[model samples]
Target chain A: MFAATMAAVLVTMILALGRAVLGPTTYDRILGVNMAGTKTVLLIAVLGFLTGRPDFLDLALIYVFLNFIGTLAVLKFIEHGDLARNAGDGE
Target chain B: MLEMTDLVDLALLLFLAVLAITIAKQRNLFVVVIVMGFYSLVSAALFTVLDAVDVAFTEAAVGAGISTVIMLATLLMVGTEEKTPSQPRILPLLAVVVTGAFLVFGTLDMPHYGDPQAPIHQHVAPRYIEVSGDEIGVPNIVTSVLASYRGYDTLGETVVIFTAGVAVLMLMGQALRFRQRDGDA
Candidate 1:
């Protein structure tokens, strides 16, 4: 059952990669990457069950936090064109 | 002899291959960064399947997380679309293909996945697994090995991360100063 779920996740990852590659807009690529990150968290958690190592879930949690920060940073950089922009500056 | 786990691993490998090809072909810097994140995610999953949970953790954190943010920050400094290369692509392509072929050849000599008798499994790994419970008393062997056995290496890694954070802050500080100067003018 875990294997089947892993296979499904792999399929989604491929689809996301395809979107990232075929992107006509930057937003499409970013969204695809975000989707892939979400699937990856699931994949890690499922693999933990498959391998009978529940400890691996720690990795999944780390990925979750990191992915959120990364996506937000990307969007901020894209919107502002500078990461060092003053926080008081209105968006 | 192939198990369900093996099938999943193979499918993930296939996905990684597709992601690599797409990343190579994409010219847009933004798209490339996004595809690279996918590549890192798949690679981390592959690491997990290989039973290297610690490796997977670091890869997911560094590869999918920090690298993506850093790349985006770089892209903000440098525009999104890649500038057209003045030089021909043939030489670089040949160099990459040759280097890749050599890498593949190198991997051919590597022990099969999860081989019990592999040199790595034979050496410190067994000792760590055996002694970690009694010595370090950590349930997670990875944590024991990283924190106790390999303390220096982990410390070095932490120092590097700290230095990077400091460098980024310094750059931002300079930028802020420049902006203030402009405003004053």
Candidate 2:
């Protein structure tokens, strides 16, 4: 059962990777990478249970945090062109 | 019958190789860096499948997280178009192929994965697994070994990361501000 689910997730991850590689727009690539990160979190969670170590969920939780932070950071850098600028400085 | 873990591991490695090739082929630095983050995610999943949870965690945090941010910040200073190298790629490609071949050759004498008789397992691993829990009072032996048995190594790693962060700030701290041309998505 776990194997089947993992196979599905891995398949989807490949699709997401394809989306990233074939991207004609920057947002498409960001979305693809973001989707891949989400699938990886799922893969890690299932992997924890499959390996008989449910504590692997702890790592999944961290991946979730890191993935979100990374995506948002990329978007912010892309939009603002600077990570340190204040929000009100539009000029 | 091969285990499902092995299949999953193989697929993940394949994805990693594909990502590497695509990232190399991309001229857009933004796309390249984002795909690099995606590559890290696949490798981290592979580490998890191999039962290296700690390694996966660090890879996700450092490889996917901190490294992506640092590289993107670098792009902010340097711009997103990868510069075309003036030199021919033939010699460097030859060097990489040779080094890769040497690496493959070097692996010939290593024990296969999960071999119980491997020298790594024969070393202090046995004692750490058996006695460290009792001695260090940490239920997770991996934690005990990393925090207690190998305390100095962890401390050194901490110092190295700290130094790297400070040095990066010293060098690129001011130039990272928004350039007028960076606003187009």
Candidate 3:
């Protein structure tokens, strides 16, 4: 059942990639990337079960943190073209 | 149970192939990166099927998570679209296809999936599993391996993260310098 679900997720990822490539805007690509990230988190959990290794989950947790921070940084850089932009601007 | 696992593994293999092909054909860099993340996710699933949870976690985090953000950051610095007008070079892609096919063929001699008697179950894994419960006391074998047997590798991973953080800081500093120079002009 998990494998089947994972296959479905793979199909969804392919569609997301297509949308990203065809997307007319930056936001669309970002959205696609975000979807991929969400799917990956689920993938990690399932993998831990399949492999009989729960330790992988810890790494997955850290990965989640990294993903969130990385995505925010990317978005900020996109808007301001630099991470150093004054935070006070609220733009 | 046997039939079910086999069916699922086959399906995953097919999906992985399709995703890889789609990713390669996609013209937009952002789309390519997104598809690559999907590929990583699928590969992680495969790793799970193969009973390598530690690798799967790393794949999920680094391959899918960090890579996507890095790709997007790079896209912002450059342009999102592929360099205009040039069709994708087919020869290199063909080479990739051939290499991948060879790899699959090379696996023909390997044990069938989920064979309990396979070398994987016989070798180092058993000791790790046995001692893990008494020595390390971590029910999660994957964690034991990462923190105990492979602590050095984990330290290396931490260093990589530190390097990435420093790189980001440097990038921000350069951007500040550029802005200041423009203002003075």
Q: Judged by DockQ, which candidate is best?
A: 2
Tens digit per residue, CA lDDT, model 1, B1-185: 98778887888898888888887777778778888888888898889888877788888888988898889878877888889845547989899989999999999999997789899999899889788999998999888988999999999999999999999999999999999999999
- The candidate scoring highest on TM-score is 2
Which TM-score value belongs to model 2?
0.87
TM-score (all chains, Cα) for each model: 0.82, 0.87, 0.63
Evaluate residue B144 in candidate 2 and report its C-alpha lDDT on the 0 to 100 scale: 92
Query: Chain A TM-score, candidate 3?
Result: 0.78
Per-residue lDDT of candidate 2, residues A30-61 (tens digit): 99999999999999888777777777887888
The docking category that best describes candidate 1 is: medium
TM-score of 3: 0.63
lDDT of 2 at B116: 99
Q: After superposition, how far is residue A47 of candidate 2 from its true place, in Å?
A: 1.7
Interface alpha-carbon RMSD, every candidate: 1.5, 0.8, 4.0
Using TM-score as the measure, name the better of candidate 1 and candidate 3: 1
Cα lDDT of model 3 by residue, B87-154, tens digit:
77889889988999999999997887778888988988989977888888889888899898899999
Count of steric clashes across candidates, in order: 0, 0, 1
Order the candidates by DockQ, highest first — what do you get? 2, 1, 3
